[model samples]
Target: MGRKSWFWGILLCGLIIGSAASGKASDFRGNRWGGSMKQVAQQERAELEFRDDQSLFYRTRVAGLNCYLIYQFDRNQLYQAGYIIPPRNRNLNGCFQDYQKLLRYLVADYGEPQENQALWSDNALRDQPEKYGMAVSLGHLARQAIWYTPGTVIRLRLWGENRQINLGAGFFRRTQEETHPHSKTVFFGI
Candidate 1:
């Protein structure tokens, strides 16, 4: 091989590697997607909430709301991260407002949602038991949104049922093998 050809070949390889590494998606707080949980905790100053064999839970705040950041790993590689907002205040409107606020914040960072939906139906209200009158009203006011990138997917949802408001943000790898392509695990009613 000629000297000039060798130089260009090496330069092209370096450019390919550099671009690939930089193009991966970041977690909600800007941590690298495939990095270790320890690195994430150190970088984000997150406190340990819980830990088991397969996942780690960290306490953090998003948009001034308490959030539990769950990190799911497969063979030591962080493949999924979830931002869970626990039920608070027992006010359906307040929960909806917080969900909207968080959605806007996510949009600012991740751009507009690819899928935004607000669903309501008389049947949804009717399906609930008579004892859950207020909850039926709240359940009729559900909203959900999703954003996608080549390397990650973000989902936001707000729904109320059984007198409890549920909301969350989920970030997941685009091609993880062990879990669903959408999210590591689904969270419902909490």
Candidate 2:
């Protein structure tokens, strides 16, 4: 091939590779969760103390879309929130049940004192007949008595409007232990 053809070939190949990478990134961007992790963090007040006996970490990724996941234990509280980056929808039914069970166990272990009453109250988990702003949406599929895991009760909270501002939590334990406390306190949308 002539020198000019060689240069063109290299440039075309570079363009193709770049376009493919960009396309793959774009796919994640489209599925991006909407909302700000910061906002979600700021909105949630810690309902319980985090026990430090277990391992946990906060993970974030920004490809075409921005996402955050809190890997506490084996499960991940993942969030893809913010403006239209793509893939803006997240249905976490499985995770939701996990949290429901955890919360129930926590309430049982700690006893539903006034402070913890809301977490255990049927009205808080399941929507009340009045259907007001604070009414939580607990699906019917996971309703059961409390069952503890990790030899300790852990309560997690997840929140978002179409993947914006997802929340996670660890419940207060009777046994005191040092733990790394982390939370998303603010999120900005561009």
Candidate 3:
């Protein structure tokens, strides 16, 4: 019965390997990485706002903020997804508070971030937390955080431009980032 035992052992090995591979390509927001546009479109259940050669866009509300949800696909397979929130209000304090609230949600989902910091281009306002948002608007500061998950790399970015606070969250296939070096964004608008 040595041959029978060997066969069963090989079968068990195959099953284990398959499950592990699938785990490495887990789902993001219920949409599996490598899923097709047709598949995502049906599940999206929202009127498509725009479509380019390689991505799909939809408008939605998240965290009480109006946002544009983007899905980036390569070869018709999903590789990235995110939400872009437009500037809500021009108040400085309101901007920073919004950033903190979004950070808490991300931390709750992905645990502590791998990197969380306010990167400064100019330290003029570093000592003034009250002016942090204004500093960001003036191109003096930016807050960034990154989290690595089993099969995804999650990123949260908060910055200001032209006196408007901007917040965005991106979920990318871990493998995709490794494959594409020097990619600031999966797509131009991302």
* Candidate 2: segments with Cα more than 4 A from true spot: 1-96, 113-156, 164-167, 171-190
TM-score, per-candidate, Cα-based: 0.70, 0.24, 0.78
Cα deviation in Å at residue 168, candidate 2? 2.3
Model 1, 41-93: lDDT tens digits are 66666887666655677678887889777666556667666666765665444
CA lDDT of each candidate? 0.59, 0.28, 0.65
Top candidate on TM-score is 3
Task: Sort every candidate by lDDT, greatest first.
Answer: 3, 1, 2
Query: Model 1, poorest ten-residue lDDT window?
Result: 13-22
Clashes of each: 0, 21, 0
**Compared with the true structure, what per-residue lDDT tens digits does model 2 show for residues 1-190?**
6533432232232110000011122211222122233433444342222212222122333222233322122122223221111123344443344445445544554454222222324445254434321233332222222212332223333332322322333322212122212222212111
Question: Residue 164: error of model 1 in Å?
Answer: 1.8
lDDT of 3 by residue, 132-183 (tens): 8789887688787888776677777776556656677777777765564323
Please give the TM-score that candidate 3 achieves against the real structure.
0.78
Please say which candidate is ahead in lDDT: 1 or 2: 1
